[model samples]
Target chain A: MIKRNIFRRTILISLFIILFSASTFIGILDIKLIDLLKLDREAWHNFLYFRIPRSVSIVLASAGLAVAGIIMQAISQNKFISPTTSGTISATQLGMLVALLLFPMGSSFVKFGFAFISALIFSIFLMVILNKIKIKNIIYLPLIGMMYGSIISSITSVLAGMFGKLQTVQSWNVGSFTLLVKGRYELLYIIFIPVLLAYIYATKFSIVGMGEDFSKNLGINYKSVILLGLVLVSIISSLTYIIVGPLPFLGLIIPNIITLIYGDNLKKSMIDIIFLSAIYILICDILARTIRYPYEIPISFVAGVFGSLIFIIILFGRVKYGSK
Target chain B: MAQNKKLQTGIISLAIIVIICYMLIKLIGVRSLFALKMIVKVRFPKLLALTVSGVLVTSASLVFQSIVNNRILTPSMLGFDAIYIAIQTIIIFLLGSVNFLLNPIYNFILSTGLMIIVTLIMYRLVLQKSKNNVVILLLIGLILTTFLNNMVTFLQSIMSPDEYLNLSAGISISLTNMNLDLVLIALPIMITCIVLFYCDAKRLEIISLGEDNAINLGLSYNKEVIKHLIYIAISMAIATALVGPLSFLGLIVVNLTREIFKTNNYKILIIFSGLLAIIFLLLGITILEIVGHITTLPVIINLIGGIYLFYIVIKENKI
Candidate 1:
């Protein structure tokens, strides 16, 4: 087992290296690998300011979303649940709309604070609803959450329309890494704190996954742990949305693929999940930038297409293989 | 006796609401015969488009829910509107706004044809592969919608500002901004689809008895489902092509009809749901006029209908 584990770890590290280099090297202005050795001022400037921050944000957002998905599924005890489908992202959008409307010239900190608070409240509300309801089919839970999301989104749209801020909201609705310059994307670093908390409490999440009664029987404080997990998910999702709009199905598909391949033990699979997520986002971001040459497609577009295709494959594979 | 009274009450209330909306639209500010004629001419097409689309969407959704044997499913859930929006965006992206704007008929045909083709492909690829798992089909449709929505957003980002504005307006549902010629063309197709659905009312009732029971009763379950799905795709395409997608209107109206009418009779259910749709659309238009905002009717419908859907799901879960 140890030998196999070491082999897997090596493979993951190699894959991460390859993806990271490719993502950093390719853009509207290509930086050839040999250029790095020359250390020219232009190349160095672009590398420091443009390429590095964009790649870092992509990696951070993807890993953060994937980790959020895992925590959500763990707390809900439903493999299909994710931040996008669970109404968390839309709730955050609604919160951001309110913040933008109230404080048009507010600093990013104030906006983030409002969004963080609203996301926490909305997610806790959703969790309470999930607890109160007895859902027979796991599918209905996500569908209900989606309905809730649409309601929130419609309210946001209506208010935005009223304020004539539809354009502002529309821009926010489009998720792109193209806008991530050095100073613009530092907020994404907020994800690191939640991700670290997630890693620290990974085992507790696994215990919560076994059910509230089971956790309580094992002397775990089920409610607080579940709340902590949700707060982590909310922070990750809300921060990603505020910084980069929404990337639908990323959270849903990546963690699902990881769990299918690596199993559901969060402690054992967390690193692989994060690495694979970064690799996936790196590939998608590269495609988004290169697809139209000087004009960039949104990162969310590539992710949506790629993620949903994989989602369909995973769903059908489950049906054919009769795997849970 | 009680069922008759309830049906009568529904019809009477719906009729009263329709009349009020019509008057509010047509005669709110008119002062003379000349003004009345001018206002009627403008409002007539808008009202016609509203009524036809209302009937098309609601009936299509009713038949869809019955055929799938799931109360929560709507035709929009099948990715019909997404396909329509994607086609519109792609056309504008490639052909330029002038070409797309000048040729409304061509645009309509292209969008409807593309939606039908996409639906057919999904039926063959995802639906068949899942062995008719409705939940899986719904999930695939949901994913397709997200994919297409993102594609549209991507194209919009690259588009020029003027083109983006036109595209955004084109994609939103508005009773006041519809093409009169397109509505005229859509009216006949929508009526025919509704008639076909009405003819299949008994079959739909049987189909809703769950798939196994229907098949055991000698119904060609898969074949009938495919037929109804085609009808649904055509009507939904026309409705979406006429007005942009109204995601939650169908669910709200159909569920309201089922609750108020309290019968499995597709005939009554279909008629009442269609009426409820019209009432909702007219109410929305009036509300928009009252509020003096540019928000489309679907926003209002979705705001209410989405909440209603959430309530229904939670209530059902509690039971």
Candidate 2:
């Protein structure tokens, strides 16, 4: 069993690295590896500054979001309750809007702060509401979560309209990695901390996900683990929104497909899940960039289209397999 | 209800009249005749569109709840709005700005036809089996809507800026600004649909009583289900295609009417909820008018209605 798990882990990481390199080579500006080896200054600068940052940011964002999703689904014990469905993305957008309105000249870090705070607040609010509700129907949680997101998003749009910032918000809503170059992308590295933290606390999150009673019996502090999950989700999500953009449904789908293939072992499957999410997002990004060559489409567009379709398949897959 | 029928009818008739008169006076203010003519020319079709669209949306939603037997579901949840947006995006992408904007009649027919066909296919597939699993169907609809919307957004990203500019005016859900010409043309069709809804009210109430009950009452449950799907598809397509999509107006109007009027009668529910929709819509338009063009009413309605929906769902869980 140990040997097989190691083999799978190695394969996943290798696949991710290979795709990451491939995505770097497909943008509008071509920078060949052969040119870099020949000590070409332009190739080196473009690759090091533009291609590498964008590709690394993609992997980081998706992996972070995927792990965050696992923790969320585990804690809530609902596959549908990802950051996107639970209003985290919308809350970040609201924060981004407020950051734009109040601190128009502030650095991206300021915006990140606003986004992180609001995202944390919104998810906690959702948690409180979910705690009070009886889970007679599993599907109802995600449905309510979506309604919560829409309410916040509509409010964001209304505010944006009043402030004449609708166009600005629209640009961000496109959710692409087109703008991530060297200096602008350092903030994304902050995502690594939450991801590391998730791994450190994976067992607790899994126990918490089982149920409050199960968690308390195992001597884990249920509320604090729940808070840690929210904070991890918020940090990863908000940072991603600031650095990249709001890539819808990635958080929901990646962990779902991962858990499906690998089972619900957070400690065992977390690394594999991270690697698979990176590969999935890298593939999507590569397709979007090439589909309309010389003019890249946003990643969210491709992800949303395919993500929803995959979600439908999974919905049926669950029924057929009766996995739960 | 038998005892209160006269009182309910009298109150409903009065409320409808009061709302209409108030909206008309608001539209045709006592300004100069030229200004009145200009205002009437612009706002009259909008008022007609809003009123009829309100009735259409609410009634379609009422029938939709019956057909699915779920109170919280809205047609928009099935992504009807996303489909409309996708249709507009595809039109602009394929035909350019001139062909799309120049032929409003063709656009109406094409848009409404496409929406109806799409919804019909979905309803048939979803309702055939798994009758007990409505949430899965709702999830599928919601997911498909997201997929369609993302496709539209991707297409629009690659569109010529001018063509996208044309789509912007047509696609976004706005109550303040509309193609009055299309509204005028669609008025007759919308009125006929309202009449058809009134005609089918009793049958719809029976069908809502679960499939076994509906079947046992000498109603061909399958036939009634098909008819329900057809009327819902046409009305919803026309209404959404006429304006943009109203995500929660139907939910608020239908549920509020059910709560306040204390009526299980589908006949009274149609008119009662229709009036509630009109009042809600007119109030929205007038407020937008008063605030004067900084924001659209649909987004605000979405905000209010979504909060109300969350409240209802939370309350359900509490019980």
Candidate 3:
């Protein structure tokens, strides 16, 4: 039965792969079919070269975000929480604001560094608060996260308003792939790879999630593990926000989708989430570029709409099943 | 004993609201209130609108809480703000600067009405199946909000720069420079909703216990919820359309009401919550106006509300 299930899953996976490939092919065709097909080889090469970096950035950013979200939900033990939902995204935005207004001439690396450090600091504070406050019920935690997120967001909003940069701030906060190019995309890869490695090596993360007491009994340093998790999450998330801007529910939705299909197994879900996020973003990117002809809908909007629909469905299903 | 405590809190909250409103009127740099022309034309009417806005936000929040059976969810979750942004962006994109300056009311009504309709449709669609799950409803609402938000952003990016700037200026919620006419118009509807809510106050409590429980107790749960939902929808439409999305103000006020009154009865909670909301809203506006002399008081409220929510969460967790 297990083998059969695996086979079925593999087949489904293959189908999604086909869909992604076909979509990519069509997307490429749509972009260049008119002029490139009629032009010489050099033009085709130029188009391909130009598109490659942006496509890679979109795929990596989406997958990393999805994986990070899955890890967060697993550690936090709540599907509703995301970097965006938990003020982590806002903290990153705050970092960007400081970088922009305070250190206007700072390099992207320096700005991202500031974002990483600030987000880490903020997220650590949240972890400490969470640790000190014994959560008797789970539902309230998300509310706290939401509130924290709003506070950070409001601060950004107020600052933006005062500085007459609300629109610029909002556009960045909204998260779009429009600005993705060869230069900025590298940063996402750099932050993503190391954090991904650290996450894998941290066996205590899984044990800690089992329960603090259980981990302590098993000689796992729960606080350190959690702090480490927070740091890892902060760095990766901050970097992604810096490069791709804010993806709204990019983190929350894909992870939840994976868990619904694959159950609570973290390792499997992690892989599923990565692949699923890639496919989801690819399709969204394709649609974004395709739907309006010369103009593109921001990928954020596509993800938001599709992600919300899926989230609602999952929530309804979960509620119908009467389980937390 | 409980009733007396609620009544006392209610009275205190009301007094605070009045004081804050008076202070806000003064702080808006509206001196020479004794002058009949300015007072009637600007000062008095502005005060009335702020007062009414506070009542509308609180009562609407209360009714929303009753129907959803959760204090956490608000109508903004249904994408009213998102739709508002979408409409505003589209209007500015299409009309340009001259047309907007030409007819502000036409723009307001058209955009606001479109938002209401779209949000209503989204709410009705997702809310139908998962009426029992508050979390589900909230999740869907957030998703819809994000979708609409994304759509607006996408449109704005492609829109002409002048159009984008024009829409952005108009979109931010502020009570500082509200047109007296708009406030006057919004006031009657706000009061009417409150009156209607007062009449249904008893049923709201029953509905709050969830539809199954309410139905078991021989109440028409669906009917009760439907009515309350409509009230919430209208109230949210007015509040958000009047002023852009004030995320944590309602959350802070509604939660504060629960904390202060320490009761679940709709009549007491709703009434007190309205008063508390007004006080908080005015207090927020006052502090921002007095200290920063800033236009973006809503941001300050959002920050304070966020902190208050965190405090409540920690406190609740402790228990």
Candidate 4:
């Protein structure tokens, strides 16, 4: 146990260092706010004000998404699953497309609200369908999710094509942290705080992970807990997508790494998730900004590509141990 | 007797599906003699390419799954998709969008042939040892995927916005732009594989029972498996080249085929699986066209696949 804790601490320290170095690189390479905007003192002050809100937005969005991912994986009992991978992102895209087409004059908040609700509905419908299927093997799970997600994505693509909005849709779907200015960032915070509290309602989620009969014996309300978890996950995921677009693999990679390192304890994973997700986003931000000097890389691809490697490594290790 | 019935059903289903597809395409203003001529000239050829490509992919996936004794694996686990995507990103970055289809047929054949040769060599080396560990293979694939993704990112970063737009726009699935020559080449390769599969139908069933069982049955399991892998590489190359990677499409189709067909016969299963893929792909495209048309076909496919995936997740009660 001592050895394990020491190893984990080492990992955390290294992660922090990498994140710090990347940020330092960004700071050194990127033009400062004053130089970037080349504005007077008043404008500079306004920029600083917005900067704080954007930082707040990043923190809230990452934490909320991380927690939602944890709750989702725990309840669903599948590490390979995430909102991004499970069609939530597609649903959000669909919602956003509709909002763009139907409510050109609507407020961002109203648009975000609609997106969140629709994504939640879609996710729940998916979960219900999943529950109905009598699975013969576990492999069927991801396969089915992949298929379902593909179908939704196909729909989104077809719709985008017809509306002549494919280009816009693609741009919107490619996640980035560069656009989180003042007004947009506040909306994320408003959504984040309440959802954080609602996560407590899903304490039974980990219990549900213990199996239905086991949970029933413990007098747990499995259905309601699952429902609450789904709602929380969907809301947070949709809002994040609306704010920063859909991040690939962050939702899967963070929680799974947290669980692998911190043990399967949900609360502990939650804590790790908060810090790790922020660090992840920040590092991705650095890579996005600095990779090409002036041009920014989309953060989604960074997380997906890198995070999936980490996931595969862990999976490989598991297989090795199992085979042994 | 059962084999005869199965063969008859297979022929009937294939014919019906093709006719329906033809009718549907016709109904969508391909009705006039001139339009029919146009479809034959333009659409039919492309559609034929897609069909053959689909057959190769499904059959390859089925054989791969059987040999590995795992139902849920795709050749993408070999990192070929990553390599394909990486090559694409780099080529686009270098060439910009200026007649991007410059000798697509040549490029497709060359890259696919190169991939096949290299993978076959690696597969041989791995198979020479203990068979490829599913997880280990996946890890290698993952690592390669990461490396390629990073390279693509680097390329995208350096690329101008116009270049990036051209690259990414063409990156995802769009079957309208396909290479006829590559499809023609894939046709013969697929036919050879199907004939080979037919020749070894019994052996494949025995192999699916497991390595030990197959060995007990005096089958040269490794050789047969390697043959299948080569076939898979060819098929996957063709399909991926034509349509990019549609991961769950084949997985869903093959499983649906097994579920509905309720048979373990490889010969029957192959035809059923191929027909099912065509029907589903056309159906999906039709749905996308008829629906709000506000989204992409892939997004819709992902949504349907995801919901099904989630259902499988909850029901199985495993991570």
Distance (Å) between predicted and true CA of B10, model 3?
A: 9.4
Interface RMSD of 1: 2.0
Query: Model 2 chain A — which ten-residue stretch has the worst lDDT?
Result: A315-324
Instruction: Give the least accurate 10-residue stretch of model 3 chain A, judged by summed lDDT.
Output: A21-30
**Model 2 agreement with the true structure over B1-319: per-residue lDDT tens digits:** 5646775776577667756664565445556786667556766667788877888899989988887676777877877888888898898888888998778778888999999889778877766644535567677777786677667766776677677667877865544456777787777877888788789888888888978899889899878777766887788888888878788999998988887777778988898888888888877776766777666667878988988877876787741
True contacts kept of 1: 0.71
**Lowest lDDT 10-residue stretch of candidate 1 chain B:** B19-28
Give the candidate number with the greatest TM-score. Answer: 1
Q: List the residue pairs that clash in candidate 3.
A: none
Q: Per-prediction DockQ scores?
A: 0.60, 0.55, 0.47, 0.29
Error of 2 at A322 (Å): 3.9
Please list the residue runs of candidate 4 whose C-alpha ends up more than 4 Å from where it truly belongs after superposition: A1-47, A132-140, A198-203, B2-10, B13-40, B68-86, B114-131, B135-180, B220-227, B243-262, B271-319
Deviation in Å, model 1, residue B237 alpha carbon: 0.8
Off by over 4 Å in 2: A28-30, B1-14, B17-21, B24-40, B124-133, B155-165, B173-181, B211-223
Write out fnat for all predictions, comma-separated.
Answer: 0.71, 0.61, 0.65, 0.30
RMSD to the true structure for each prediction, in A, is 2.3, 2.8, 4.2, 5.4
Q: Native contacts recovered by candidate 2, as a share?
A: 0.61
Q: State TM-scores per candidate.
A: 0.94, 0.92, 0.86, 0.79
What lDDT would candidate 1 get against the real structure? 0.83
- lDDT per residue for candidate 3 within A1-324, as digits (tens), equals 678657856875886677554543454334554566687686566455546566677777777777667656756767777787777887988888888898878988988888888898887777767766765446556656765766787888777777877667767755667666456577777756744664574456556768788989999887777777777788778888888776667788777766677676665556566767777888777887789866777777777777766766666667777754
Worst 10 residues of 1 chain A by lDDT: A315-324
**B42-145 per-residue lDDT for model 3 (tens digits):** 54655666667667777877777677666555666656666677777777777776787566567656765776676567557756776634555565666666
